[model samples]
Target: MKKIALLALLLFLAAIGLFLAVVWNGYEWHQKLTVTMDTPNGPLSASSVQQMRLSDKRGPWNPPEGSGVSFTLSGEAVVMELAPGRYLFALLTGVPSLGRLLHPKMDVIDAAKLLERGEAEAYRSVTLSRRDYPLLVTFGDMNDPASVQRVDPANLEASFGPGYRLQSMTLALTEEPVNTGRVKKVLAWIGPHPELKLSPPTGRTSNIPFSRRVGEGDFIRGKT
Candidate 1:
């Protein structure tokens, strides 16, 4: 009976230790900023964004894995931060939720520089079709082994069917924190490390598209 009680206490202590470790590693300091879109009507706040990509001095450092960091939408802005390095911050917007005025736009900015400047702006104009298909395509034939052709706005009508329209918008980023209380500031020593499994590239292409088709739903649903 005494042995059983002692064993139970050991297990409980071990569990508590594991939980504390997880909390320590997961915590991080996040910077906050507001996003706004300028359109024909007027300036509107960007409550949420579709996707965000980050690249540090080493290379691509995506959320929850590469950098173990992700952005959170708070009211009318986003909260996030990098792990003490210069980085390129890319944000993708133009989902159905934002309305037709906004189209798929990828805005890339130098994070450190933008922070120092206090603001940054990006402009975009793109044509989109009603149907869902690949916007870009690569083609090659056995007869032309050495020749490969790439096409943008691919010829396939399915890729660009009727209901085609053009969209133009401007996005602005300001280094302003709306809700300071929501920001989580963790110590640098306890931050999580990158969990990348693949080895770094050695003069070879590392980006290859999957055979599957990805759409707006995939982005919103967090399926991709």
Candidate 2:
């Protein structure tokens, strides 16, 4: 009870702080940053920088888009205002200067299955805007895009960590043939958290050992 009360107070304080920042800071605080994919040889949208993820035709996965664009806060430029929701950085233009996204036709679903039955090792790798804190990622496929399926955070909090919503998901990039096992291994390498709470597509879920599911809503649309 004491812990719960303290947690509630903290949440309330955070909400108030965010509201103040939004009101006082205005768009200036959240003004989007723009950069070019020098190799792209074209123009692009500034929004992708905080929303872009390089993946197959399905979208949103490892390696991230815009290899030439701002990779993260520490990349081409620095990020000033950080938020709690999901963000991606792209090379203004989706197309990487004439270069194309690899494995544009691969299926994230199949890649996930391989990761499940211990047959695949595919994973998504990308940099983050904030370089200070270790970022937490919740792997999502078709079956459980949110990963948690809106069950209870208590079920996942131990593995994915707390205060982290869905930031982004990683998908396979090789189409001709994807070594799911290998991909998972790669994702595990860049992934700050090794113990993944893999929630298979069968509606069942499992925690990697270091995650905790604190509640039901832990599986927010983006966080799950």
Candidate 3:
């Protein structure tokens, strides 16, 4: 009977140790960043943004897979900020709740390096087409217009309209702490959730106001 009790105690201690280890490795602090973009109509800012996530795990386990930040600008676009050390940027159309459609083109942006450099700039051309949906919006790299991917009409979401036009835009990032205190950090670690949570779209409202002009070129400038 004594041996059985000792064995049970050992098992309990082992379980406690494992739980502490998981909590320690899972504990992380994140900062919320706001985004602002310059458009043809005016400067448009993302209504919701996901916090930048960093994990305590090392090696291949670090950051897990497909883990990164995202910014949702209502009916405008969804920007997925991916790649850890070297960031890769992709723009999608749609909202978070309804589901976002990915754009074939992906842009690489070294945010930390750009922060040191003061700013980063890229030129792009915007195109619009008519489909079963209201409007189809497409963006291409002006530097290499020929290389732009030909997206299938079925893959696009009907979001924009005639007045919608994007010429030049600037993206700015400002970071604020999300988990600071010990109690708050522990609570955050225990009940982890997605960095950005937003409601579904209501109707065909124009969130991004763009010019009706076709084949227009735009500048994408970023600042830390």
RMSD of each: 17.6, 23.5, 17.1
Query: What is the lDDT, from 0 to 100, of the residue 181 in candidate 1?
Result: 20
Q: Which residue runs of candidate 1 sit more than 4 Å off their true CA positions? A: 19-24, 28-34, 49-218, 221-224
TM-score to native of every candidate shown: 0.24, 0.16, 0.25
Better model by TM-score: candidate 2 vs candidate 3: 3
Error of 3 at 60 (Å): 16
Ranking by TM-score: 3, 1, 2
lDDT, candidate 1, 1-224, per-residue tens = 99999999999999988655554332111132233323334443322222222223222323345443233222211222211221111122222111122322422223323333433232122223433211222223312212222223223223223432122222323333333221112111111222221123245355533212222222122211
TM-score of 1: 0.24
Q: What is the lDDT of residue 124 in candidate 1?
A: 28
Scored by TM-score, the top model is 3
For residue 215, what is the lDDT in candidate 3?
A: 18
Give the residue spans of candidate 3 off by over 4 A: 2-24, 51-53, 57-224
What does candidate 2's lDDT look like per residue over 1-224, in tens digits? 99999999999999989655443321100112232111122222222112112222222322334212221111111111112322122212111210112222544333333433333233332222332112223333323323322212123333324442323222222222111122222222222232334332344366432224312111111110
Among all windows of ten consecutive residues in candidate 3, which has the lowest summed lDDT? 215-224
TM-score (C-alpha, index-matched) for candidate 2: 0.16
| Candidate topping lDDT | 1
